[model samples]
Target: MSTQVCIIGAGPSGLLLGQLLHDAGIDAIILERATLEHVLERVRAGVLEQGTVELLERAGVGERMHAEGLVHEGFAITREDEVHHIDLSSLTEGKTVMVYGQTEVTHDLVERRAQTGALSHYQVEAVDPQDFDTDHPHVTCRIGGENIRINCRFIAGCDGFHGASRRAVPESAIRTFEKIYPFGWLGILADVPPASDELIYASHSRGFALCSMRSHSRSRYYIQCNAGDSIEAWSDDQFWDELRRRLPAEMAEAVTTGPSFEKSIAPLRSFVAEPMRFGSLFLVGDAAHIVPPTGAKGLNLAASDVHYLFEGLRAHFLEREDTLLDAYSQRALARAWRAVRFSWWMTTMLHRFPDNAPFENRILETELAYTLESQAAKTALAENYVGLPY
Candidate 1:
């Protein structure tokens, strides 16, 4: 089939981009390797940055979120037997984050698209962007051993890190900036009740632990783990013990930890490509860059990047001014790098080093204390955590 824009991957970015284009009366095709059910249920991030929530509300996909998502006021940073809260609500003028998973966001966007009868091709494979001329780009995809081709005015590589999008760029034009941390986070979503109303970023001598609430009843938590540590190695007992270690003695009683529903370790890393666009194929989301999950910046940054891209496209189509369109990559990178910096900062502050380094632990402890006590430090964390300016 032919369309104005052909989007690879039906993740949040790809699907949202299609919806935005459709609203503008522009035609687009979304290709996904996974089934709709799989995409809708793949659990990931839950924190909704202020800008992301606004984008969803504007797109008319946030009614359920408005009713169901939990609004958080602020989060705590704990160290040295003390916990202090950073008032995110006060810092951001009541612009707080919502506890809604990326899975739910995908479901909402999918339902919205389905309401308009815009069908996306699901469970397809071998999506290749080729035959890029100045005027037209062709996306070749395989379905059930059949070679199907999609023609388009432009191709958007919203497919993530594992997809063909990033490597599709010519080697000469690719400038990859990357940093991989020594630690990974073992994230868990439990059926048991949440231990805290707001997130707690605890820098402990043992390691870092984060207790976050998805709802009043559902708990989502994580701890810094060895990159090679298997979830199989950590039983229910071990998880709770770790959670207790991170919690202060008095707060430990308040923390009613529970059984884990989901468990997986994600390595911490920050990476950004110098230029996010290469000819007709423009990359977005994990396809373009990955921020460590510390600052809760991953999903929100993707939403922000594509939001500007849509604005740029609107200007290109409606006003025929390439001002924003020409500046798309630069505009996106401006916001992308800010989140990158914040994520790196959070990662370094929260995660403990393995070396028998009394010095590093002391330094991290001091930093955490400053973050909790100093209004300026708390404000910086709150500002970045709430959302970055678009």
Candidate 2:
């Protein structure tokens, strides 16, 4: 097979970038190692910043989201039995964040790409970027059980954090920045009404808890757990019990547990690789960086990367400007670093260390108090959570 571009992974970054490139009359093929069903069922980030929604709107994939999505004006920071609210509208000047799943966005892109009759293959095993030529590159892969080779002018490594494509790039040239948190989150998606009108980031002696909703009938809640905690150890009843404990007294019974569609354990970590591009290949989404789930930045950052990567591709293929391609790595790194810093900061603030040291406890309490009492701190968080603006 031969094309102008070859993308690995059918996730949001790859699918959305393919959508943009297809709209620009640029041809590309996406290869995925997992079944479409698996992709559709994967549960991840649910928050979309203002800029991401706008891009989706322009791409015509925003119809379903606009109809079904929940728009929020602000979120609260809770500590010492008091909740400090940051009005996103007041701080960001009219920007709003939408509660929409990354899977839904991928579904929209998949349907739209199918409507356009673009080339996309699922259940592929290997996608190797061979010799690189700036104007022409080659990808070797096995789709289903057959080995196939694809030649292209450019390659997109959107496979994800534990994907084959990222390893294809030599390790010597890549400098990775990473940090691991002492705790992780155990989350459940239940068909219950939400406990609060806004998402709550609660700091308690037990640990960090998040109160968030998925839909009117489906609510998502998370509890801070040991790094090695297992879902099997916590039965449905235990899950609900922990949720009740971590939540404030006022919200003890505000949330109910029902049949849950998804149960997941996500470890907290921040990771980023410098220079998202190497020769004719480029990386996007999880392949380039990963933010801890605390700040709800995973999907939003992936969307932002696709925006810049697609623009860089457009610059090279349509406008004959290679300068943007040369600068793609540096441009993406800037935003990636910012998100890394924010995710780390939020994680450090909200999570409780196992040591339970007196000094660490004071630091956490002090920051939480500042967030609630200081308008400047609240405004800063409001601006970041809403978005960085386009």
In model 1, pairs of residues that clash are none
- Candidate models: Cα lDDT each: 0.84, 0.84
Model 1 CA deviation exceeding 4 Å by range: 356-361
Task: Residues 1-390, candidate 1: write the lDDT tens digits.
Answer: 788788888999998888888888778889999988899878888999988998887767989998989899988877737787788999777878898888889999999999987769999988888866366689898977789988887788889988888877887888888998988898888876776777888877788888887677878888889988998999978888877877898766677767777889998889998688776778888887899998999999999878988887777777888787667788888899999999998888878777738887788767777776788888888889998789
Cα shift from native, residue 96, model 1 (Å): 1.3
TM-score of 2: 0.97
* Position 219, candidate 2: lDDT: 86
For model 2, residues 1-390, the per-residue Cα lDDT tens digits are 899989998998888888889988999999998999998888877889988898787666999999988999998767636667778888878888999878788889889999999999988886788876356679998987899999999999999999877788788978888888877899998888888888888877778889898777778889899999988898888888877777677876687778777888898888998879888889898998999988888888888888888888899988999887787888888887877777887888888889768988888778777777888887788888887753
Error of 2 at 264 (Å): 1.6
Candidate 1 differs from the real structure by a C-alpha RMSD in angstroms, to one decimal, of 1.6
The best candidate by TM-score is 2
